[model samples]
Every structure is written in C-alpha cells, then in structure tokens.
Target: MRSEEEVFALLIGFAKSDERIRLVSLEGSRANPAIADDEFKDYDIAFFVTDMESFLSKDDWLDFLGKRLILQKPEDMELYPPQLGNKFSYLMLFEDGIKIDLTLVPISELQSCLKRSDGLLKILLDKDNTVKEEIVATDQHYWMTKPTAQKFTDCCNEFWWVSTYVAKGLARQEFLFAQDHLNQIVRPTLLLMMSWKIGAEKGSSFSLGKNYKFIQHYLAAEEWELLLQTFQGSGYSETWEALFLCQKLFRTISKKVALAYGYDYPNYDERVTPYVQGLHTKCS
Candidate 1:
C-alpha cells in the first residue's frame, strides 16, 4: 500500500509533468482541517487542463495511477445524467486499498469553479499561475449556522408535519412510502436540530462537520446510544421502533434548541404523537 504522502507526491508529480494539465487542486476531506486524518480519506483531486475531451478519449492513461479495482467515469456513462457540468471524473479504487477521485476541468472554467467550490481547497501545482492567491483548507462552509426564528419554526414544522405522512403510509401498508417519509423528509430536519443543539452547547459557532458527523461530541452517552438505535430498520417492527426513536430524539433536541434560541416546538403530545399512536393501533 502506498503511503498518503507517496500518493500525494505522485499526484502532484503527474500534474507538474503534464503541459495540458496546467493546475492541480485538492478538495473534500483531505482539504478539510476539522476532519481527523485517516487512511480512509479519499484524495479528491482536480486537474485544470487544456482539453478535457482529449484526455477522456484515452483508456490506458489512467494505468499510471494504480491497478484499478473498479473505476467509474461519470461523464462517459449514459445511464445517469451528469451533474458535474463540463468536468469529467475518474472514481478509482486501487488494488492496494487506496481510492482517488480525480476530476478533469478545462482551465477556462476556473472562474465558475471557484464560485461553486465548498471553500475547502488546496492548490498542489500551478504552471500558469492562474490562481491569484494561496488556498487554505477549512470546514467553515459546513459549520452549524445560527438559525433565524423563521428557519427554526420551519424546521420544527417540517419535522412534525412530515411525520404524519409516515403514520399515513404505515397505516396504508405502504412500507416504501413510510420509509421515504421517515428517511428522506423527516430525518434531515431531525439531524439539523441535533446540529443546532450541538452548536448551542459549543457557543453556537463551531461546525458539526458534514451531515452533522461530529454531533456525538455534544451528545450524552445514553442519547448517542438512542440515536444509534434509530438506524435499525430491518422490518416493519423495526421501522415502528425507528420512527418512535426519531420522535423521541426530535422532541429532545427541539426543546433544547427552542430554550436556547427562543424557537417553538410543535405540540407533539397533544398532536402528532397521539395521532401516530392511534394510527399504529389501527394498522396493527
């Protein structure tokens, strides 16, 4: 297995040696200073090049990286529409357990690239000096922002309102519908509330990392255990348990957020909870 430094050196060396590739930049976790360094962090690299299509035409060029366990070129594929917009990528995992997600972009698109970037970026090489300033990686973009009163109320309303859809789906025996409501709609707001609680505990200024991954830092041991329990959804029985846990977690987090920030939590006991309990009885 190549060391992280060795892999990074090779990536930079490759970019420096190629004239078509005028600049190189690193993004994602490697660029995020808040994230604890680990071997599993992927090398999210982008090469600012002269001609993206010229590089895409060749298959053997990528052999220099490593023996690919599997590779996915998103722009080259026909099934899913590409969101990259003028950028091409190689999502490659090497046989030696190293993964590198490399993207190719035309140098002409640098203006737009800077605007869309998540603010965690590091320049590795630049032959033309297209970048005017030094880049420092930070997780500032993923920080838990102080929510406005409207935003807080909206989050609470969304969590309590969408939850009824889960109850409706479960009563109708539409497991897929229930799963979507719980997973896609309600869960994100629950996660957001969790982040706000963490932010409140930590002076309302620190980041919770991407998707609130650092939330466990502020959570009590029993709360974290309960949060973990919410992820178990093997069957209908487990789905009910998961929904119940979501309600419990959301109630706990929202009250903390409301008290800290002067927001209002929905009346779960008088409204959604009993309605859901009745739906569960009817469905059973």
Candidate 2:
C-alpha cells in the first residue's frame, strides 16, 4: 500500500508533467477534512484537459500510473450510460490495493463541473487558473435540510402508504417484491425521518451523509439494533423476519418524526398490520 503522500505526489506530478492536463481537482472523502484519512478512501481526482479524445483513445496511458487490478471507463461504455458531459472516467483498483477514481473533463466543461460539484473539492494543480472561483469543500451538499411542509407530509404518506405494498407482496409470497418495496422505497423515507430526528437533536444545518451511513453515530442502541434487523433477508424465513423488523422500526421512527414535525401518520398502518399478521398466520 502506497502512503497517501506518495500516491498524492505521484498524482500531482503526473498532472504537472502533462501539458494536456491543465487543472487537477480532488473530491470525495479524500478531500473532506471532517473524514479521517484511510487507505480505503479513493483518490477521487479530476483532470481538466484540452483534448479528451487522445486520452480516451488509449488504455496504455493508465499503465503510466502503476499496475491496476481492474478499471472502469464510464464514458467509453454504453451499458450504464454516461452522465458527465465531455468527461471520461477511470475507476481503478491498483494491484497494490489503491483505488483511484480518476476523471478527465475538458477545461471547457469546468463551469459545469463546478455546478454539479458537491463542494468537497480541492484544486491540487491549477496551471492556467482555469477554475473561476475558490471551492469550499464542506458536506453541505448532503445536509439534512429542513423539509418543506409538503416534503414532510409526502414522506409520512410514502412511509405508511407504500408499506401496504410490502403486505400485499408478502401475502402473495412475492418475497423479492415485498423486500424491494420495504427496503428500497419505504425504508428510505423512514431513514429520512430518523435523520430529521437527528437534525432536531443537534442542528438542522448538518449532513447525515448519503444512505444515512453516519446515522448510527447519532441513533440510540435499540434504534440501531432495530435498523440492523430491518436488513435481515436471505431465505424466506429471513425475509419475513426482516419485513416484520422493518415494520417495527418504521413504526417507532415514523411516530417520533410525525410527533416532532407535526406531520400526520397515514391511516394505512392500521390496514397493513392485520393484513401482515393474517399472512404470517397463513404461512405458519
């Protein structure tokens, strides 16, 4: 494993030597001061260059860095579809265990990059000073914003209402569909409500990070355990247990959010409880 200083020095040195590469900016956890540095943290780097074609045309250019275990060129592929305009990316895992997500964007698209940037940006090399404004790399992009009245009501509605889909899927013995609705659609709303509670506890100005990864740091022991239980899916029995656990956790978290935020819990919780109980009885 290469030291952070060595890896970073190599990155900047590469950019500095290449005339095609004008500006280099780093993003993600590596650029976040709040996050502790670790080997697992990717060197999320972007190089603002002149011609994207010459670089995209060759794979050997990557060999200049080091031996890579695997790499992904997003813009070059058709399957996932590219979101970044005039930008090519190489998500690389080196043979030595270093992971670097390197992107090459035309300097012309620098404005667009800044617009979409999550603010966790640091300019490593700005030869021509192509970057117009200074970037303040904060986690502001993922902040637990004070939800609008409609957003609050909508989340409450979604969490309680979509739960019936899980009940229906379970009754039909469609475990995958049940788990999908329960875990994907319904669970996110529950997580949002939980974040709202955290925001209330601390301040609404802070972020919980994406997928509520940092939520456990703020959540109570029982809450964390219940949340963990909500992920219990492997076989049919496990899926059923997970669905039930999800229900319990959702009810607990949503009630707190409803009370704190003055949002109404929808009436569907009453309908789904018996429906799920009946299915459990039938399955037994």
Candidate 3:
C-alpha cells in the first residue's frame, strides 16, 4: 500500500493542524528500534488532548485517514469491558491495509503517561514540550530474564502440575476445556521454560518478541516441529498425543534450565504424569 513516510506524514500533519491534539507519541512495534519495519506493523499513536469527549463523539475526522474496514472503540463499549482504565482506544484497520491502535488520554495525564511508559515509545509532536528528557524506544521490558533457583523450581512445578488439568478435561470429553488448558495454561508454561533456556544460551537481555513469536529463530528445526505437534486436533486421542508431547518438551527444556542453575525438579512431575496417564485411560 502506501509508504511508511506517507502514512506518518498524514498522521503528524493531521495532529499538527488540530489545536486540541496537544501531544502525539508512537508505541508498539513501530516505535521499537530492534524491530524491522513492515507494512503489517501498526501505527500505535497516542494523542494527549484537550477535549477527549468531543473527539470520542465523532468518527468524521478518522474518515480522512483511510476507508475504514472495521474498528473497535473499547472504552465506548460495555460488553468487552475496558482494560485501559481511564484511556480510550480506537483499534482501526483501514481499507488499504494500514492498522492504527490510537489511544486518547487527557492532556492532564501526560505526566502519568511519561511515568508509566514501557520505554517502547517515541514522542512525535509536543506542543507545550511536556516531556523534558529524550525518549528512546527499547524492547527491554520483554527481555529474557534469568530466573532465580526458586523461580526455576516454580516454573517446573507449575508446568507438570497444570498439565493434569488437560488430562482431566480430555477424560471428561470436554474438548474446549482441555483446549483452553492446553492453549492458555500449559502452553505459556512451556513458552516460559523455553525462554529460560534461551536466556541461558544467549544473553538474558534480549527479547523473544510478543507471545514468543521469535522463539523458532532460536529453536532447532526438529524441536520447533515437535513443538508445533503439541497443538493437536479436537479429538481425545489427538489431545492426548499433544499432552504427551508437551510433557516431553517441558521435561527436556525445564531439566536443562534447572540443572544449569542447580534447581531441583519438583516431585509433582514424578506423580502427575502417571496420574494423568491413568486418568486418560478412562477416555478410551
């Protein structure tokens, strides 16, 4: 579609022409120095403004940006329940394929924004020069941290222990519940353990990207393929296969992390796998 320069020119030009829009900052991947720029990257813009309500009341101004494909106003709706506290957001996908997650916070919150920013932010336009220091965007918050010995033990214990919940749901033929356990609880534990291994091998200062999306870059081809296998079909047999493989991967990665730090693997692993294995037999 359009070039990044063209899109940003439109954004900055629009903000500059509007007196109510006091400040602008770019956030997320677009602002991350370590991330390569791409069309799919969202223009995560925040406008610290004078009249938040009047802006929230209108959709006409956004029309000049692009033809709207679909958009979400999280703070305006009740069903999804807002998570930004006092902030309002417009999650937009343009007809031409540009995405912008624009947030509107009161000008009064400028100090609060600066104080709480995750560091992946660049101030674009500040009318009153509210920000004193230079903002350098960094993905330092998502870096792989070296887990403590106790933390290593906790990760291992959580992985093996929660895995049994997947077995419980599967044995009851509750595919959705089992899948939730596999996707939400079990997979995150596996990801964290894998990240710990990455931290040990590489330096613990670099990020693996959101949701471990960059993890495959560090994983062996066969290991990555096996990790993919941990996501199986809806059938009980398939989920059982997935759970078994999850245990295998977790055991391998977590053991390395623990041994590197001299952390003890929990007794739960000794008991839980077989406990789940026995329970799973009922599904057959």
Per-residue lDDT over 176-210 for candidate 1, one digit per residue giving the tens place of the 0 to 100 score:
99999898988888888888777787866557766
lDDT of 3 by residue, 122-236 (tens): 9989988888889889999888889998888788778887898888888888899989988898889999999988888887778999989899999878779989998886688
Where model 2 places Cα greater than 4 Å from the true spot, the runs are: none
Task: Arrange candidates, best TM-score first.
Answer: 3, 1, 2
- lDDT per prediction? 0.85, 0.82, 0.87
Which stretches of candidate 1 lie above 4 Å from their native place? none
Clashes of each: 0, 0, 0
User: Tens-digit lDDT track for model 2 on 82-146?
Assistant: 88776789999998899999999899888877887888999999998766777778877777776
lDDT of 1 at 54: 83
Give the higher-lDDT candidate: 1 or 2.
1
Structural similarity to truth (TM-score) of each candidate: 0.95, 0.93, 0.97
Top model by lDDT, which number?
Answer: 3
Model 3, global lDDT? 0.87
Give the CA lDDT, 0 to 100, for residue 40 in model 1.
89
